[model samples]
Target: MMKNTRYITATVLDGNRLEIETPDLPIGQTIEVILVIPETLQASLTLSDRYAFLKLPIAERQKVLSMQAEAMIEHYENNTEWKDLMTGDIVEYSEP
Candidate 1:
């Protein structure tokens, strides 16, 4: 069976409950819920930080870039499937 998907942003309330208010949704219909947390809270660079980042020495900048690349690799390995550009298919990571 095909399903309709709707995206809604909700805040977690006390006791780990999410309060969602949407008039378009039916009162008694069952729906699947997928929670996507924002990444800005963890690793976002602000405008002022961007200026400071540009002023960093070459070695420091390379270190920062390497760290970010590792973080991206780790995040993708843990939470997502990789898309193979040559085959145009999604594949799970397997250790080489």
Candidate 2:
């Protein structure tokens, strides 16, 4: 897991007792949300099978994840300026 480079947050309230949430991370070519924990948590409010990630079909979940990622990528790419990875050219990333 990556630690604190950057992240996006989504807060969705699922009724009163449940809330849907995930950490949105930006990777090489896309942003990703980790819906599953690689290890167990150390609290009473542990995430389990009640989440949408596990409840929805994997394929449909992936589509939604992808949409979120694309929007996130577009957000930063549109909001910031970037220097060419190789060339010294400074370019403001504007969504076309």
Best by TM-score: 1
Candidate 1's displacement at residue 93, Å, is 31
Across residues 1-96, which tens digit of lDDT does each residue of candidate 1 receive?
A: 655655556787999898888788789978655344345663565788678778978866775676567657778888644545436667799999
Stretches > 4 Å off in candidate 1: 1-39, 42-44, 81-96
Estimated TM-score for each candidate: 0.40, 0.32
lDDT, candidate 2, 13-95, per-residue tens: 66634343344533444533454221233233446744745688887677666656776577668865453444676779989
lDDT of model 1 at residue 24? 89
TM-score, structure 1 vs. true: 0.40
Question: RMSD in Å for candidate 2, one decimal?
Answer: 17.2
